[model samples]
Target: MTEQSAVLARPPLPDDGDLDLLLLIRHFELALLDLFGQGLLAGTTHTCLGQEYVPVSLRPLLGADDFVFSNHRGHGHYLARFEDPAGLLAEIMGREGAVCRGVGGSQHVYRDRYMSTGVQGESLPVATGVALHLKHTSPGALACAFIGDGTWGEGAVYEALNIASLWRLPLLVVVENNGIAQSTPTACQMAGTVAARAEAFGARHHRVGTTDIGVIRDELAPLVSEVRLENRPLVVEFATHRLGPHSKGDDTRPHDAVREAEAHDWYRRYAQSDADRFARADEIQRDRMAAIVREVSARPLSRWEPCG
Candidate 1:
């Protein structure tokens, strides 16, 4: 047995619905990579492979009224919110029936209250402003922004956090800290910690270290409540691992770090704990993703004209 596997306990498989969403995202990302390789896709994509659990876990917690501002690695966040793989795939493929009509491509997508951006620190300020609007207009609704740990270097992030704290906006900042930001490690760039930065702005901060959806939701339930109803800004950072490269085939990490990420990946853990259930769900999603690729690929390139 591998030493890493020996130390890491098996994570319990989530329920049927949760398992389906998780695997759906997992397969969807894998399909994207395949498409990119085949020269069937345009523009670049950042897959949230190992970080799928973050958005899937936060799925049920967020209400339809809540707004989610996503960063570069936002496929999982978009999938969890809408579950429209075909539309998103079409968007990425620049095919007809895309959510943003192909103009947004992979990084930028706008659908009602959910949006994703490729910019590092853009979403935080926008989410903070939306949170302010929700506080007054929607009453109980909140605005959640999903950011990477690398975004901590951005001045706009601190600016938005300050405004969120000062205004007591109903904002939930979800940090997907995968350790590496693009090719650079977080330790190499970031000083102090995310918790400290959030504290500096007086925003409540919580760090999540487990992959269990139940445990994560249970721990954050009341804190989310505080953000939703009490008009407070909260930052929940997940200690996640990015299994895939930053965009395409550009993972420059040392061999050991990649192995460490693989060790903590939930895919093997779920399959190991319940092979029968995991296998069925995995097959279902894999097939679903394959079908989505075929159907979206056949559609004509999306066309959008600017207004005169």
Candidate 2:
């Protein structure tokens, strides 16, 4: 781990609200795995797992008017933005209250100003275009897109960045650099760092090593403001971990790699450092998610009608 990431290996845990949000995402993801394991759900889902803090930290920083484009592993992104776990759960489970009427399932959810897709590198260009629109139509509202480090390989990402930089659009790219992409280690696929790539396109780059929500928000607040005020493209890369498999049962890392990821996980660190606080919060969310699963599963399938 980087020295910066080590700065908060122990917990003087975040405020209650932050802790709750983090655990909520954690438990929601855990429930997804359980549901998948038991054959309770169909279709594919990607859980953010250890990287939940990325969106949790940015939730308060983002405005409702700002556009958010999410990638495959974006449950954290959605939950953090809307805080409507029931809707998301229903969407995933194909229940009556689904956000997208059960058609989008896990990856292709759409709500006002927030959208997510299963395809890699697909959202950036769309986000870039939206940023341009936000720049002209809604001055302060920016477009933020979450992408994995593996997405750096896509030429469309670079194209989007070039236009975003040239047009001085309010584009914020959050890169979750989890070291591995699907079954491939990033070291095996990436030639240069995400920072270097963003710099090459004249977009500003910021590295986030610490998992502390307050610290991350404080650090990025100014940069985010810069994106809004100056209308420049910024890439904030998080040195994060993915504790679960790439998808369900698709992890290809060696045993030691998984152990290393676990060591860096914020959940483990917080639980170890302040068990009294962490345990209660974790248990509450876990149980709450369990209740949600039961409730959503019992609901009838959602019906979708084509718009006339």
Candidate 3:
């Protein structure tokens, strides 16, 4: 057995009660939609409208020392971890108060211990590198890379997985399989399942369906503990759907009736009574956004520089 695994056995699972967190994420995404519609945000933005549980499920499991690497559609991940919707809005608007100082926009927002990139399949390798560093420096820490189903075909992802598994790096690779990658459906993009690929790489793999927060908490909490304790690579494939388009102005693909119906059912089942909670959260976030808009507007238009 590895020294790290021997020293750190399976830890206790996190408690339930992530419903409030989930609702907060949902409202935050809705606010982003409002901001985008008002043209307050520069460049294209991707919102996790229906797939809030992917990040919300993982939030309680992560430690402050742990690292999170996200892909293009990663605002939910940032908000869930950092809980600073105003900072995110500022960054997306290219204001100086943004996490990246008006440099990295919606796709390239990064803060301490949390990083995201606009390119697909890029975060996996970077996250592996962070895991490698953690193995040597902070053996207790773990790194998580959030990628989409579209990124599965990238050679970089496999390369990172191979290295992580070979080195026994403490990494959790999360694939948010939302069925559609950009405008193209998953059927046209790739073959085989994400779990099979992880198995091929000799990493522990777990698959979960249904976006219910309680179901995800019950299913993922234990798996997250195991991954952190064993100090080994893990791949968790979350079967969810994206209710919104891939990005701004890219809603060409037809919606899946079955997925839509299922998503609605799940939301109603989980978030029905949370209307008051959502309203409260929404009001707070809206007020913060208003402040951000005013602050950004006060700045010279030239300060709204483009992000690379």
lDDT agreement with native, every candidate? 0.91, 0.92, 0.75
In each prediction, how many residue pairs overlap at the backbone (N, C-alpha, C within less than 3 A)?
0, 0, 0
Tens-place lDDT digits, model 3, residues 116-166: 988888888889899989988987789999998999889999999999999
TM-score of 1: 0.97
- CA error at residue 89 for candidate 1, angstroms: 0.3
**Residue-by-residue lDDT tens digits, candidate 1, 86-195:** 99999988889999998888889999999998889999899988988888898999999999989988999999999999989999999999999999999998999999
lDDT for model 2 comes to 0.92
Q: What is the TM-score of each candidate against the true structure?
A: 0.97, 0.97, 0.83
Model 1 segments more than 4 A misplaced: 1-7
Residue-by-residue lDDT tens digits, candidate 2, 110-210: 99999999889999999999998999999989999999989998999999999999999999999999999998999999997898998998999999988
Q: Tell me model 1's lDDT, rounded to 2 decimals.
A: 0.91
Best by lDDT: 2
Lowest summed lDDT across 10 adjacent residues in model 3 is found at 6-15
Model 3 misplaced regions, further than 4 Å: 1-17, 255-267, 271-308
Candidate 3 local Cα displacement, residue 15, angstroms? 10
